[model samples]
Target chain A: MTSPKDNKSQIWKKDLPKHTFILLVLLLELFPLYMMLQISVKNNVTFNANQWLPITPDKWEWGNFVFGYNLIMPYVANTVFVAVTGTVFTLVFAVFAAYFFARYKMPLSGFLWAVFLLIMLIPGVANIVPLFVLLKNMNLLNTLWALIIVGIAGGQVFAIFILRNFIEDIPKDLFEAAEIDGASHLQQVINVVLPMCAPIIGTLFILEFLGKWNDFLLPLIVLRDQDLFTIGVGLIYLDGEYNKDYGKIMAAFFIASLPLIIIFMFTMKLFVKGLSAGALKG
Target chain B: MAQPISYRKALNEWPLYLLVIPSLVAVLTFSYFPVLSAVYHSFFDWRGGDAKEFIGFDNFTRAFSDEQLRYSFFVIFILVIANVFKMIPSIAVAVLVHRLVSENAQYYYRLLLVLPMIVPGLVTLFIWKFFLDPNFGALNAFLDITGLKTLLIWLDQTFLHWGVFRADAPIAWLSQPKLIIPSLIIWGFPWIGATGVLIFLAGLQSIGTDVYEAAELDGVGPLSKFFYIELPLILTQVRLNLILMVIGTLQGFGLQLLLLGDSGGPEGAGMVPGLWMYNRAFGAGEFGYACAIGLMLFVFILALTWVNNKFIRVQK
Candidate 1:
């Protein structure tokens, strides 16, 4: 019912505030990252003299990256191994458990789901002491397997929660049609349930990967060897050793952050979708 | 109700049970067993060594009477309160982002907001640690350049009457007891993380356009529409976020440990209970006492979660 000119004015009025707010927030969020990048490329002398200046070509010290990479590359590789292995194991177990919970009849299903819910409610900090003891008793301390096993177990509850909901919402007719074609329970799970639940599975995969990759405390406790350190634990060590060397510290931070940033750029939509769906449906 | 199933039916259902066994075993070993162990160890005098004595209720009583533990409780209380207030700005940002008219603009803003999250949390803490360093910190450099350093020192002197800094000296943010908590609170200003905004935006998007159209036809202004419609609809997300923030603050001490170490900074200003528990168990080898502290925190979080559930009923 409005004229085109009036609508145009209203659009301008609405967008001006929105644009200003968004630009301000974007700057605020980017400032720390910009600072980190600037410091990473500066030499020690220049960095000490001018802490706030952006690095020029003459002042840029590419050696900082070399030094940091030499120091922490092994830890980064260790983290990649743990994250991938943990995510695969978590997804495998979660898919089976969620399929069972969602599709098939089981005794004490409600009670078992309640037990999983109780597991979710327990504070993670409470488990650390006992988990440390348990791992030591099993002679798995300082090993990558400890991290992988614990990560899989910790991540399964949330994964199963999401995947169960996703699988349950799949059309019931699909399973019936598969059954009529002589698809066994295992066949239905592999052929129908897995294909239909791919989106949620992908979401859970990224979530679990990110959790394992960025995890600090458990790895700090369980891993004692320098070679076994995750990137997070390595960064703490780097921070301690290079406390006064801002250039090297910032370099370490930048290198440690690169993988996640790359993954996030490619999977931005999925990441957002995963977070929203987890919060809304949880 | 007592009817027996056929063996064939039972055989056919066996795969489903088998499929769930690994997860069951993992949880039973890693999650449930640890919890049981923690509870069992709380009553003992077991350290890391083999020697153990069953000291019933001693650890719990000692924890209750310990002065440092009481101070830690106070510190955690302040942190939780600060975190609760911190959500206001996050919610405001989410509301602003949701109000953007253009879909492309909304998408871009959401992307920018979430982009910061890609930086690992430890990296963020480290960046802040350097950013808040007394000398050569970005914040102090900015303050010096803008002629605000003198003003800040004067304000500190006038309010606290300490005169601890020279006119040219930069403020030691993390080193001073008075400034540590405030520094921690203000570490990430405009504290709207991506998870919070995305969750709030999801809640907002779930509201039907027809509701807003009707409101517009009824001559409701943007503020009224927000308060009467949008805010009410997003309360569910808000409550969920509140519970999460509470649990996170109560259980998380990684930032404190990273920033201040086991000493918890000057005068124990940052000695949260979680960090206390960690230091007691691992640093000092007081495993049983630490377990008692952990169990106490568990009960506190459980009670708070229960209260939130009972009291903060979401609007239909």
Candidate 2:
């Protein structure tokens, strides 16, 4: 395309500004995280010294890690349970509904699609009142099942919409061929659509998992039991009790962020493929 | 081709209907039911007894007149202004990354931006809380090292208003009423960076390369290219971002609770609608009034979004 790029140095020079800018932006974006890491390593005594430098020798507190884990173990367990159960429930319903929307051109299909869009537009806070009443009347307060059910239901619109978009992109000819081979709709969905929808399904799983994991408001309202609190809820309550305990509070914060950061680091490759991973999912 | 099936015949697909039933029920029961019921709940006054009474127009009037509720709008307004500076920087950084790097490198940066999104909110709060600590914070130390002694008062209201932090020194970070919203704005930058950058980056990716190539051929420089080609292309995204921010402010609760430890951070400067609702229900045990406030917020957000949609024409 240009002077037969024979030298790496020349190519690198041509891209220097862009590269520098990217590095700078990445650092800016990561500054707080770097600070978090530095603080996590240092104890309250070292933090009180008010130095910008990382704990050289005196402030190091690896004990915070063990203590933090012990403190947050139950909350992490609760979070995992909700995220997994919610994802499972959402995936089951979303996949079926997405398949129906994508494959068949039923009457009122556009209207149904519009309904999903409308749901997406409305803020989640809008429904807090009646849902609270409904759950309370049904004797479901402070229960893990309440979270699981509400989370799965609350996230349907975007999940269905995204799954439908991805599914629609799958060539219709493939589904037609399956039908011609004497496959029923369910079989076609399972055999043909499921595999093709893998990337989207993966994206939705992570999205839903993140949503349910980071959810604070719903759980704050519904769950009164400390043990029933998910990570977000648990973290709020934990910090409230130990606000000034910087080492332990920061430790708890670090622990709460650990699972997600780990997942993201491992899955960084997937996010780059133009994936719509931020879409809210049930 | 086979004769077209009747619409009635198509409706007989029991399996299809059955498959959609679970999701339909979930959406209707959880989403639709509550939305309608919130509107219904707004009109009635109940004090948790058999003394339920229809008090049409009363709750709406109260929300409008209530000083605390009215005061929240000013807080929201200030917060929006502060976000502009931070958001502009984030988007500029994001756009610069988009321009300089190949798709692969840009993706890496994008992932970096999303790191905070995945981080639990509690973690972010703690990180910022520590960072903003005036006595031993990296910020104040750096300011002193730079001979900008005024920076020590970065957290003070008097210094913040008088802009004389270096002189008087060491303002209460959370105690001042005027400075509280600004403080929230500063803290919000990192939190917003995670999701805001992602959405904008996605919006940037959707701009067609051919348009840029065409602009280049037309002798358009970088600034012109961004203004003419890129900016207009992402107008819908801007509208989306604004609407999201507005609605989010209306729903702001958890952040304040974490930051201020439940008293709304010095003079109720940081009190927002969502936190107000929480206080009413849980703190004051006025479930009926809280429900009314929640309903009002819902309507207000919906109306705001609808107006924004009308103005922005959400689709290009």
Candidate 3:
């Protein structure tokens, strides 16, 4: 093995370059975020003057954020309501479904699992037309429930796929032990499966939340009222309106992004762990 | 492994059925019903409202001969190809991160990489929209500042004969026809997203230290060592990512939809199948035709996925 002293000396040749390269790439990756943050605090005039460099503190336009916050906060509220409700329902259904698949084998088990798995193959882009029609027919056309119900249906899938594997991998005796204590079917799900699978579920929760939060197409199609618009559709509207005002538009983008930032700030560990588990990082 | 619950015993467990039904009904009504409904409507001349006329194979035939649709496929093909090259940077970064001697550096680099992802994807999209704005965009400003715009103009004038880059006017990246696909390709520069890097890193990190030690004993150089050992070892992750990128790139139109509008930029140059489908359904109210386009996309995506699964097994 090489000596630690030699390693320290030659580190300048090899390791230095690697670090510099990584740092450079990291900065590039972070460029958009930098652009968003810097631009958010400037008004139309100052922004018109300098689109590339940071605006000085003297000219910082906190009013842009106030404008953005007033404009999009309702949509933000709508999104939070939709995303949370959608994520919770999606997880509940996914857990129940995954638990069903994992714990038991019935005549229709393969067929049922096939029903779930096959839907994964259907490019969701293809089905949007019909789904839009469906929301209309179901009287969910202009309502937030449209997003909630559809999100529950489409988003549960990856979670179910992951959770099934997880539940199946959980030692069977734990379920048997819970059952001996008179755990009902629901109780076993709550007590036994939930604990063992909490980490995976947390991962699924974040994924579902992010997916719902980012989804604009469904909201665009389903909701007609501007008041009911989610952040995705709302942001598009904001972009259209504020095309001349980069500061306010960037502020809107920054504000729309905060919920997720706050969420991951707490759940970053679980999120990273879950993604790195080689699950539906897609 | 636990024994499978007998069919009879499964029937006895009727209470268990409750858990599966909500999910089942939701899937049936929303997911499966939409597929069935889309298939049914693909053959009709149905508007989004109620008017329907059964026009068997007409939509399909229209799609077959549609020139814009044809152009869209060509554009998507280019995008898919560009995406293949884009996969390299993530792989390279993963390999570099994997090779880092300091654990703390590796951890911090990974943390830095992941931090950008917390930004909502749409927010990122919009920021890029601003970043690509012709007169006001940072890209044009950067090019102007660095004199690359001048160089590009000279090259275009002398050899290329292409007229995209000009010294006087800012390059209209999204609005210009010739630049749309190029803009789409270069939308996310240094496209080393955390999901890609981390997945590849997971695969790379799984490699035992002894393998590297063995390679070191044989005096293997870094480049060949990468090719023969590191690259081959992470083939599974690479293949998985390639398949994902292909499928995603082929099906995606949101970026186009956001950046280029429903008509898909100038001359419809950035139009892909998905955006074409969206245009048909939403723009023209050709729900039936859009469904047909979507089906056609589904078939291609399914075939590619099948081919990837069947023939491209990596040595694990």
Question: Per-residue lDDT for B189 in model 1?
Answer: 72
Error of 2 at B47 (Å): 4.2
Residue B153 Cα positional deviation in candidate 1, in Å, after optimal superposition = 3.6
Cα miss at A85, model 1 (Å)?
0.5
Q: How far is candidate 2 from the true structure (C-alpha RMSD, Å)?
A: 3.9
lDDT tens digits, residue span A98-193, model 2: 887877666666677677678877776756766877898778989989999999897787788778878888887887799789887789889987
User: For model 2, what is the error of residue B149's alpha carbon versus the real structure, in angstroms, after optimal superposition?
Assistant: 4.7
2 versus 3: better TM-score goes to = 3
Ranking by DockQ: 3, 1, 2
Ten contiguous residues with the weakest lDDT in model 3 chain B? B1-10
lDDT of 3 at B45: 97
On lDDT, the leading prediction is 3
Give lDDT tens digits, candidate 1, residues A31-110.
Answer: 88888988999877998777776967786899999988987789989999999999999999998888878875566666
All candidates: CA RMSD (Å): 2.8, 3.9, 1.9
Error of 3 at B54 (Å): 1.1
In terms of DockQ, the best-performing candidate is: 3
Off by over 4 Å in 2: A1-22, A49-51, A56-59, A107-114, A171-184, A273-282, B1-5, B47-51, B101-108, B147-169, B190-195, B202-222
Give me the runs in candidate 3 sitting further than 4 Å from their true place: A1-6, A278-282, B314-316
- Best of the candidates, TM-score: 3
**Which lDDT tens digits does candidate 1 get at residues B202-250?**
8898766688678879999888988998898788889888888889999
- The first chain of model 1 has a TM-score of 0.92
CA-lDDT, candidates in order: 0.85, 0.72, 0.86
